[model samples]
Target: MTIFHKLVSRFLISPEKKNEIGFCTDLDDILRDDGKVTLKIDGNKITLDLSNLHERRYAACLSTSLRYPQYDIDNLLMAKFVRKGDRILDGGANIGLTALHFLHFGASFVECVEALPWLAERIREIDDIRISVTEAALSKRSDGFVDIAISKTHNQGSTYDSSVIAKFSHIFGDDIKFLTTPTITIDSLTSGPFDIWKLDVEGAEIDVVNGALQSLKDCPPRVIFTEFWDERVHKFASVVSASHPVAYRAGITKDNYQLELLDMKTFEKNSEVFFPISPTYVFLREDCKEI
Candidate 1:
């Protein structure tokens, strides 16, 4: 091949489709040798470590778009429920992106709960007074710790769920590492009056609810955005029924970014129809269901 053709083939385009990602020319400006990227979003700077193999996809997006990728449903939920001066608990925060989004959407304060120590430290390094980081896995217990399964490829896919671990083991085969992380109950974290909560603790949403029964009763949040699965749907809803009477499966419309709310009753009857899709849900207080 000629010199120009060789340069185009090697740097501009690749024959292998898998290698096409994370190959922007300006990548060196943001991505460092250690795989850290200092991304500027809407004038706020967030430095993230995207060294993990699975994290490169995010790095590629951050470098190109200058936005932290988030689920449209989450953006919709936050836009609708997160009122000004709202206090939010961002449980299972991965590098505090969603928490930053919460702040951007006008929340006065966001308490981020993360399982991995390193990830929590990254959030703290942001130095934003509106955001605080707590390093602990949410569980039914206030003391002791839990063993979480961390995947070598997908750091954000860490979980303490047995079913998830089994499935990941079968699929990835020895790429998962077990780490014992500190545990804390949702009730023990604060004294209440939080306006909103975003919980994405894999399949442990029920345990978090169980651990926060007291807080849920005394100082119930107006809205809760969480993840739920087919097997634990009913139990998960039942646990928080007293505080949050109405539940809806949240998602963006197939055509556009419109918000779609499916009633829990309807979702429960036909969950298989939405399987492998977004399992995120919104539980609302009776008075707040109109939103």
Candidate 2:
């Protein structure tokens, strides 16, 4: 965030309220020499270790500690669909926050795929069991490499996907450069049936799902949490068709606080209401009458 953004977040919003609403605090103010912070979530005081974390990752520790109930759509999806022994494929698992949450929810195993090496390192540092972190993007090419434009001061990261690169340029300036990262397909990553596939790959959401077709065919996930926008709407809609099942769009309120679930009809009609990185969705294969 910029200096102006930090100031506004500091004076206009109380630290307690900001934590409650999932608003990020200034990086320096939150971390001490020991690289840990004591935070209150749902009135429970907790101290999270961020010792080996990157500056950009402190937000993950904060959100994970609080579970961002009001802002993180994944938190809501897990509450509704995930259960003990369930296996979760957390594609684009930034900092592994949601992956940790899955384990906390009793998931027998959770595999997290992250493109950035440092973020992947943080995931492993956060836990040692019931979770595996891979520092590679899930793509069509098993041996391919993804070029990513990374934001050094913020959590923004993007791949060479047309829409993503465009937005990356717009946000980080035209001269921004990309670092090549290893890539692997989902089919090559997992061996057995998984219960849910959670993706937050910015604009590469469709590509990751497409590459996972073989895996989806062999052992379809009961639930899929996708982040979509106009650029990838067709691919998303194609996978979500008639008779698939009932669906709910999960998003935050205008202020980025308060989770909202919108039915398919409401979602399509209000497409313009969403902005990138602001919402994620949850879809299920179980029949409406069943779930």
* Candidate 1 lDDT tens digits, 1-291: 333223323443345754443233333343333545566655667875556533443544544422221444577688888899999999998877788788878999998999998889878977788888889998998888888987666557689898776755653357566899989998898624589988889878888989889889888999989876555867888898998989888655433336667886675575544423457888899989896
Residue lDDT tens for model 2, 70-184: 3355665687678888998888887665776677676888889888887788677765567788888888768888788775434445665777667556655667767799888
What are the lDDT scores of the predictions, listed in order?
A: 0.73, 0.64
Q: What TM-score, computed on C-alpha atoms, does each candidate reach?
A: 0.79, 0.72
TM-score of 2: 0.72
Spell out the clash pairs found in candidate 1. Answer: none
Kindly provide the TM-score of model 1 when superposed on the true structure, using C-alpha atoms: 0.79
